[model samples]
Target: MHYLDNLLLNTDSYKASHWLQYPPRTDATFFYVESRGGVYDRTLFFGLQTILKEYLGRPVTHAHVDEARDLFAAHGEPFNEAGWRRVVDRHEGRLPLRIRAVAEGSVVPTHQALVTIESTDPDAFWVPSYIETLLLRLWYPVTVATVSWHARQTLRQFLERTSDDVEAQLPFKLHDFGARGVSSAESAAIGGLSHLVNFLGTDTVAGLLAARAYYHEPMAGFSIPAAEHSTITAWGRDREVDAYRNMLRQFARPGSIVAVVSDSYDIFKAVSEHWGQTLRDEVIESGATVVIRPDSGDPADVVHQCLQRLDEAFGHVVNGKGFKVLNHVRVIQGDGIDPTSLRAILERITSAGYATDNLAFGMGGALLQRLDRDTQKFALKCSAARVDGCWIDVYKEPVTDKGKTSKRGRMTLARNAATGHYRTVPLADEAVSLDVADAPAGYEDAMVTVWENGTLLRDWTLAQVRERAAAERL
Candidate 1:
């Protein structure tokens, strides 16, 4: 068996010794994951289903146990050999854990419980925290999806304000360009797919593959024929016009779109002399929309200049919203783009009387590789534990950092039907009164059991996830 397939060895070294440290007679431990508030007010819950389907759906084998035992023994860490062997022999190597989570693609408020896990068997009390190292990595996809969702909101705002057809243009406004900018192919696949949860345009093939393989989607993203610096500059500076014309001749069919990078020599010269003057008639006569890409200089300024040049050459028509929509031309700014810069460029364009339909954005590093766990302040903490036979709340409240304090007791994510607001509430018990008039009226648990033991209880498709993400948030 491959090392990564060995669940026993796929965690922090400290986890190997945690089984010994739990209080005597501890029966089970409950843990939950949440975003403790950072960057965004809400998070688009995602990627947990992929992780569950990929890692936890398989049963462990004796070979995995033997490998883990040898590795931990040689590495000077205490191994839970007996416990693992018992799991293999008695449970057929299926992990005895129950995982509950908010539905994938739900846009949940920060600082609320998003996922909960607990051991389902008395002998597997240590299983919850043992897998923390792997499970907590959900922070990556969740953060990426949250950022992309917020970007979608920003683009939707601008499109609504400046474009006549907001719905027609909003979904393709932000395109994923982060595949090469990420750390590994796996990171690209996961982060790229997360971005696609909110937008339909992408250049990351790995993300599309991940969506298909993990989420049962045939195709999760779309891309048009586009040019890179190498493809454009390799034509030599003198033949730049030929390069531009070739892109049109090769890919620009009636009603189709093609993008060509125009900054190889001078973006202004390429737009003015080549696209605007020499090939202006061909661009118009082709009956296709030609997308001009400016890959250098200040994004807002360059985009503004490109739009100005394109408008001067091809002209524009006033949309019903009274904003200028360039004729047969558009600009895609792929450089120095993040949420802040993207909004800045849109504001600049809208202020200049240009519709959001005249522009789109392609984000790279900022979309995938730039964030960390603290970007959304994600945390997984022990909330309740079973000691002897009684369940008790467990939490940490450090005086030095009040923000790090975790929740107490077993919790459930409850949503108020009337207000569409969400809050974390303690699971109802004998001591807790949930029927009070002052309590959250019309509140119901929004979390569902997604994984139990080694079985996947619910499977979410990419199309369903996209629909949930596109729904208007209350």
Candidate 2:
């Protein structure tokens, strides 16, 4: 991982240590005391406790023992923190709760409750439901996924530019570079993971850590630019060739691909005069490749011209089919490239005789920080909520067929047998029963038992989570 290791959230990197200190993070020690009146009403105590446990991924640690607080039931005593902890211990990590939802990669529209949570404990029902809105606050939206889906489509345009029947995998990596730019740590990690699921990227490495332990999957890594000590000097025509040759020699290798931030001096002259010939032969002979990243200039023009330079070098670098020298120096593009910019650049590059295989686009700010016209470039919505003592699915109904419209109250989202995409419909009352085979999944089933008696049931490695999200994307 090119990014920092360990968790940005309160979670511990070491699972054992995290479990030992788990109680502090769960509600057993703190009842989210503020929202008490709103969520923990008189009739829904048990469900609230359950919801807290689920969210914390652990059991209630300060289990109250004095249960006769409601001195109405048999041997009922008001339980203290210890007593409640005992209840959690006795039940192990298995609480009678259920949650379900569309798999991570599923695209949901506005107003749709994507997941639902419920339980057998009547007093505890709405309590856990309190977190329903909060959880999806992180889950639903995938700016990168939405953008990446468009990214994949956009990339196809680049590939199609070349007349070759040769199919090429995505060369330029799409990274979840949104963490520092996100509102919260959890949101950043989960949002990054969502993109990884729908596209290939390694933004929130912690999500990868969780995914890997939860589900065995492959994780991606970024090749970071090195700079223990860095210096930049403006170059004139005289020093251009030497600067290009030196940098090219420094990073090129058999399996290594080096990207030189071109445009340091004279953008076009520097490449054609200094880089084009020597850089091309080295990459081809060394069985490696070189990429030119012009940070300052119009992306479309620079990329188009960069391709033309590579075309000029192609004739000089060829040796054999696989061993062919840098006959194809892919245009490594970045500066000021958003989805719109990406489309324009690809269109221009293809028109100039460049194959996507011979080019890669690296996007940073523009793509990572795009805004939504719906006033939500991407937002996680509460798809379903526990209302009127029962859980119901929800979705967005297009009111004016304009922007985001109606919020469907209770609905079931299912993949049409004919089409893999989801189709939203009403959730039946029969789903309340666990044994109902056709019961549509809800937020309750999606709730995985992470903790027990203030102890995590098992460890989930970030690599696991990253891997799972990656596989889900495929």
Give the winner by lDDT: 1
Q: What tens digits encode model 2's per-residue C-alpha lDDT throughout 343-447?
A: 887677555445556556655444444533232322223334444544454445566753343334434444443333333445455353222255344322222
Every model's TM-score: 0.97, 0.62
Error of 1 at 39 (Å): 0.5
For candidate 1, write residues 30-108 as lDDT tens digits.
8999999999989999999878978888888898988999998999999999999889998899999889898899999
Q: How close is candidate 1 to the true structure, as a TM-score?
A: 0.97
Looking at model 1, residue 112 earns an lDDT score of 97
Error at 190, model 2, angstroms:
3.6
Root-mean-square deviation per candidate: 1.9, 11.3
Candidate 1 lDDT score at position 10: 75
